[model samples]
Target chain A: MADARRYCTLPSPFPMKRGGALHGARVAYETWGTLNAARDNAILVLTGLSPSAHMMSGAEDPSPGWWEGMAGPGKAIDTDRWFVICVNSLGSDKGSTCPASTNPATGEAYRLDFPELSLEDVANAAHVVVRELGIARLACLVGCSMGGMAALAYMLLHPDTVRAHVSVDTAPQAQPFAIAIRSLQREAIRLDPQWANGGYDIHGDGERYPDMGMSIARKLGVITYRSAMEWNGRFARIRLDAEQREEQPFGFEFQVESYLEGHARRFVRSFDPNSYLYLSRASDWFDIAEYGGGSVMEGLKRIRIERALVIGVSTDILFPLEQQEQIAAGLEAAGANVDFVALDSPQGHDAFLVDIENYSRAIGGFLAKL
Target chain B: MADARRYCTLPSPFPMKRGGALHGARVAYETWGTLNAARDNAILVLTGLSPSAHMMSGAEDPSPGWWEGMAGPGKAIDTDRWFVICVNSLGSDKGSTCPASTNPATGEAYRLDFPELSLEDVANAAHVVVRELGIARLACLVGCSMGGMAALAYMLLHPDTVRAHVSVDTAPQAQPFAIAIRSLQREAIRLDPQWANGGYDIHGDGERYPDMGMSIARKLGVITYRSAMEWNGRFARIRLDAEQREEQPFGFEFQVESYLEGHARRFVRSFDPNSYLYLSRASDWFDIAEYGGGSVMEGLKRIRIERALVIGVSTDILFPLEQQEQIAAGLEAAGANVDFVALDSPQGHDAFLVDIENYSRAIGGFLAKL
Candidate 1:
């Protein structure tokens, strides 16, 4: 089992988010398995939203993913075989350096003083971590949704460091729909009164911003992570209390509303509001074309990868089947060895998380070919 | 300008939104055109989300819609001829009986005490006004979106009163996607501290809820109302301010963001927040089949209309062309003379509001034949 001891901090040569640069803003990350002598056996995993470097992979995994079943020892990202490394993304709340992280210079958390981070800035920090980990070359870069997005950024910024990019249910181009949905979630957080215009260090004034804000934001993410068809099938607009058939008397007595609410409350416990905001904005800002001066092909042509696998779910409306095709097309245009396998599952964007057997087999074969 | 010269206090026959049953709920409304000798030239144009009884036609220079150029003299509605009657809908901020309207008992605003109105409830309220106005039969019943939805409910309830029923951009059923979208808007309002649990008396404590919440909600509305292609063409991530030239900042930096915020602000000024919630919920809860014991076509068959025109916009992603097609199919199945028109427009869900020339000509022709 991979433990927290694998975590390492690589300081950024950039400023604090709120203000002046931190001569070297530290990026805390972790690595799993052993790097081969050729250093080509390494795989980098970028965290989604607020996930720390510990995108866990082990035998008796106590706490699976946040992607638990997907990236385990005998899973899609075969931890027992391939050396996996995940970085606690910069501007995240989990064990990483972010607003909530205490500023060494000021002896206080950066809070409002935290520097504003774009996807580029976040990627730069991850680049430094990969470089400092003594893995000059890599076999693949894999991630999901936002993490998948960060992986895209990693490939673009550190093109020479990796051999291949394997995106799980991700598109190189940020579609308008995804951007729109992500903006809604970001607005939900930024609009909170206690977010205090991005201030409030101590969670203070006996007025901690309501946890419901983050909860609501997470529910928004959950909706996007899956398809409407999935919700329709899984839940029958069921009321929370079956016995109390009060009908639609006055308020939201339906089970669906209660179901969404419960989902929201759980997100409040494990995730940080600011990290969610940062990561969401990062995903929305993801554009390989933007990085390449309006040519996605030009951007990808720079990638020197031996193999690439683009995986997506059938009913995953968020990622969609077409998006995976686009990713494969982009890689093929770049003359990279690209193979796209459409995972037939109704889990929507979350098929990678739920459909273990299929994903694990596909991942194993992809890695074996590499 | 038209004004209601004579009005009477009336009790609502339905149960109050809070606990007690509301009686004598005064309905305020207005009429256009001269009553014929036979007293049957009335064409009821039901108001949608924000418009007042003043879905104005011949007011001075002819006020642009609250339908935004859709209904006007010589337009599809043709206030120049047909007796146009548009009321401030029940549960609206307009001069209709709503949350903000004064409660007879306490003389205070009904606010939260306003019942969670169903589409039927809204239609019934309009029903009372139509009967009181001395119109034995309507020449045509026309509604758009939520109002369009209300028209269907009205046709179901008072089939004898409506001669030709036209429902534009209305859903035959509430898909989870639609319901979830509406719920997202409601959550935005409820989460706002100033909402004060919907008990915020509009005139209370200077602690007024930021109409900003409603504005944001409506801004979200504006996004759904129009097409992304249209948005990209009109305001392609263009910076709203000089500062945003380098990056896509939050708030109203992008022209699109400014466009959304403008809509939100305008909506808050003219619309009731609580009504927005109730109406949105009503729109989400609208299931013609669910209401009619699982047979929407059976319900439509009962509505005896001379002729009807169902209009759908090709680019209307929100209302969608499918919904309009469904309306026509249902009406045709019901043995009604129905002509269906699908207008090609880039206006998306708000094609009815934006594509005035095409809509006017099409609707005008339809009305002439009817």
Candidate 2:
């Protein structure tokens, strides 16, 4: 596979949001299409928690990316007429300076020793990459899921950097339900003896990995990522064939259980557990209220943009549609032209990734007018 | 504490629904009010997964039972006019023959050696107690949550035994979403190194218990048992005081997290993990469709109850209002006068337990008319 990623070194002794600083850190990013001479057609894309910088297939790397359905030459995020840059999150394992990265001082993985991560820190790191790419200002900024939270921080910290904004399935802050789910996910990993207090062998066989903990965490995540409605329509109460079930008690019996098991197994060994812990906690800690005198709407009003489109799915329990409406109302109160669209997508918070048709229509229409 | 519970030894070699049989098994029960001369005023109460036979406090045991608010002298299921019998489930550790009970053949705890449990088994065992009490027929049968599933199996397996039925928040079969949640809960318990393949030291101290795994599982349960709306209204984005947080990386921070931890800690050592696993899986494996030629509606049609009252909460994501409506429609089609009441309670699936006002009104009204 051709290499599609580019790295930009962050300022040494980069200040973190909570505490401490990184002596030497870098960010990885990928871009599609060409940047105009005016540097005004650049659209910087921020991703959810787990995705890499590669958002779509391109000449540099032909492998299909996570958001391949929504971003391409003529897709919703049409690269044919715009420049798009997707940045890997700062606390992710996908070619970024994360907890899995080596610490210059100790010559070992930072692990839990990494400074507390915040959306502000992620925004700052992504901003460094944007500056290095010679883009003085972005024409549009698209943030999806966790990326939406980071995007809010980005605009609040670096005023006037973005002209247009598209917030997809994100909240002004972490709600109690979201916080509870994340806390349990973190507990699942920490309870595993194999985790060894974030000191598990990073380069070892399955025996040394926190496989069970990570699998349980990932399974919990997959359950909440999609809506119950979608699960009802898809798997229903379907049972697995007797031949497919394990002989032991409490083993996989239902198709839904099998599906969750498959997802967990595929994800368990891929992501770094420490990086996951950091990112998950950072998401819970982020609240726009911190910036707005304990008011989410007030904090949202702090972001000044020319135009905004806030899209949410009705079935999204993680970040309900009301949060998206609040964003639109807050942005509109700030004098930005805001278009709020609530789509009846059964895909829940993951609608932006799977309900391409509905998302493309709302997003494409918003960008076209912009 | 007084010994309010009564025991009735089931017929020796009590055959189970799935395949195995239990010898010298006994069921625990408690009764309020008095059996009428005609034995026609008897009301059999079936409980959820975890409750004991003690549904409410009485003269013998002046302690608050699980449904203290709804059952007593003049409460919803008024004991003044009806004989209310609460039976502990067959596979529960609460004063019943379960995985925690001794295996007479081996003189050891059943543990994983317990026979595969089904709701049918629970209903049959409860029926044995009712029959031993000299009740030829019941005036009404009340089932809540998991108990409701057992009630369905009860009425289907033994026709004409129950004249009226009250089905609380439950489903005809486990949906994929509920199955997924329960599957993860079971996995959490089994993954604990201390589980020791269901041979963990039941009588040992905290060091020998599957404390971490049970805590995680209970936390997950608490998360699902309540609604997100309730969490938003109750805890919102409230953070815990620094003094309350543990001085570790991923320690409790949010008030909701703290609340879940409190609940988990309180429940971790109280229930037997092996029994929990059996009952949870039994819930997953239950389906009314299994008896009605693969049609849930047809299965409902087979039950010969005269009148039925189905109660569900609007905010309940576990059972949902649609399932209640399905039960009502199916029973109505079967010539029974069914009253379906959907209460707009924010308490979710647990509303039947906490939203006492609404539940009392609906339940009291139904029984009064009878």
lDDT of each: 0.68, 0.91
How well is each residue in A1-370 modelled by candidate 1, as lDDT tens digits? 5355343455545743334565435677666566777767788877656566767644433455456666656666676677887777777776667776777778877765666666666766777777777778777877666677677777776767778777788767666555666666666667776666566334423456646456567766666676556656676344456654334323455555666667787667566566666667666666677756787666666666667888888766456677678778877887788988997776677777777778777777788777
Give residue B221's lDDT in candidate 1 (0 to 100).
Answer: 73
User: Evaluated against the true chain A, what TM-score does chain A of model 2 have?
Assistant: 0.99
CAPRI class of candidate 2: high
Q: Which stretches of candidate 2 lie over 4 Å from their true place?
A: A204-206, B204-206
Clashing pairs in 2: none
Model 2 lDDT, residue A333, Cα? 90
What C-alpha lDDT, on a 0 to 100 scale, does residue B170 get in candidate 1? 68
Return the top candidate by DockQ: 2
What iRMS does model 1 reach?
3.2
Q: For candidate 1, write residues B21-42 as lDDT tens digits.
A: 5556765566666667676678
- Residue B289, model 1: lDDT of 76
